[model samples]
Target: MTQSTVPPLKVGLVGFGYASATFHAPLIAATPGLQLAAVSSSAPGRVHAAFPDAMLYATPEALYACDDIDLVVIATPNDTHFPLARAALEAGKHVVVDKPFVLDTSQARELIALADARSLRLSAFHNRRWDGDFMTLSQLLAEGTLGRIVHVESHFDRYRPQVQARWRESGAAGGGLWYDLGPHLVDQAVQLFGPPATIWLDMEQQRDGALTDDWFHAVLGYGTMRVVLHASALTAIPAPRFTVHGTQGSYVKHGLDMQETALRAGAALADGWSADTSDGVLALHTAQGVVEQAHATLPGAYTQYYAQMRDAILHGAPVPVTAESAHDVLALIEAGIASAREARVVQLRGQV
Candidate 1:
């Protein structure tokens, strides 16, 4: 039997919301080995306007069934992630699901099993791991400049006081700020320190008439080390993005990387686009004394995810954000939800 040559991966996108339009689509189109073949959106006209050369499908099924599309990137609502990803995998297409993975661990496991059975690449778009500030921190940690991490604090705060009427504000599966931002925080913790022995979460709805949790604080207990993950919709005065205390010194940083904002503002991916970012304020506590703040360079590369995904599909490279990592995130989310419901600490089992 003569082997067939596989052309470049044809990528299909679902949903044109903030994530797809700003993050996924632009990054996918910028990636070299992938092509924006089609998009499934109810607002077909808008999709056509954004991607004039790409085919527009009235339904996700239509997009998935197209013979030309080799990968499906799901950027839909939290509730639809499972169903669409499952359908894509069953249809023999490689799948990339946006964050929060799914509402529950069972669904995540099911999709994992399905992808494994089909020998397909199944991944979550946990792109924050590539944040420039985070990249700097990762380097410091690996170089032992921070020594043993004792306490880590991560925050994703915003001033969305007037809750927009969306499924995220509703009391639905994968709803609210926790679901929206928890994956990034939790994934960072897991990447740095692995799984926790126990998790304690406090969640509430501070917004008027809000149905889902708009505020959440979770503490991942890793023996002596602790990671605090917090998010709130009512933050008027946003706090530091990252604060870490270690035996050798402590690091405090404020503000988010500017790549995503730049990408949303129609910045092209070429040149120094993704590599540029506002220098994060860094205050390091040394034995001599607290060092004065300095501009810490951030080398953000959001395009790296798509590039790796393309290579994984084309050249059999390792998928940077693995399904196992996503499973750990979902499991932590489940534990956090459980803790909030029962008002107690939840012990995590499996996946150490």
Candidate 2:
């Protein structure tokens, strides 16, 4: 098919909640060659208010059955991701599942095989890969400026001291900060250093009356390298978003990505939309003394994920976040959970 003849792929979002409203919907609308054709939401008024021209379905099943939808985006809760994605793929639609792809690796593998059999594009929205700070860090690593990374620390702390009445904080399957934020950190780690050989997890319910784990500290061991992932609900002052130390130097980033804040404030997509204001500190161990310098942050492009997905469907380009890569994340998550529950270090078995 010629580029000029290819129409915009009709997209159906399966949820209109925080992830849908804040991240997926805006990014989808911003990307070219992709159309937000419909959405599945309990509150049709909310969907209509945000996207008046798009059709609204009362259930995911209805949305999956829609012949107009060429792609289905599953932005619902963590628990619903697997079934919803399966249904969409079964309906002969390309699928995109939000982060923490699914509850387990088995589910991820199933979806991957199904999508492969159907010759459809399937991806997990590991959008943090597009964060300005992370992008900068990735560049630095690729350049080998940090030189033989020995220790890496990544954090996603928050001060949600009050236990909210939500499924995330509830004592349900796929509930807790571990499952919520673990995927981002783990995926980033795996992207940088491949899979860890061993995993050690320490998870707890720190907030008062919190039924699920509100805090977790996971240690991923990659030979001599150590990657620590941490998140907490009671943290008043959070730690650095990323800290990497190597044989040659160290890099420390202070703030989280600004895209979330921008989207929350309803900022329009513009030039330099994802540029970070704060600079990361890089300290190099010179022969004479340690030389410190400020590293310019890279511009993040979350819309690139959807754009690549559009290209993959229209032009046969590679999907940005493949189901195989996301399956590795789910494997790490499962290992972490087992390590925490069994009070022992778990060895990663398969190829990541």
Best by lDDT: 2
Give the clashing pairs for model 2: none
lDDT of 2 by residue, 49-128 (tens): 98999998889999888887999999887898999999899999999999889999899989999999999999999999
Per-prediction backbone clash count: 0, 0
For candidate 2, the TM-score is 0.97
- Which whole-number lDDT from 0 to 100 does residue 125 have in model 1? 98
Worst 10 residues of 1 by lDDT: 1-10
User: lDDT of model 2 at residue 142?
Assistant: 98
Candidate 2 residue spans exceeding 4 A from truth: 1-5, 349-352
Off by over 4 Å in 1: 1-6, 275-277, 281-287, 293-295, 349-352
Per-model TM-score versus the true fold: 0.95, 0.97
lDDT of 1: 0.87
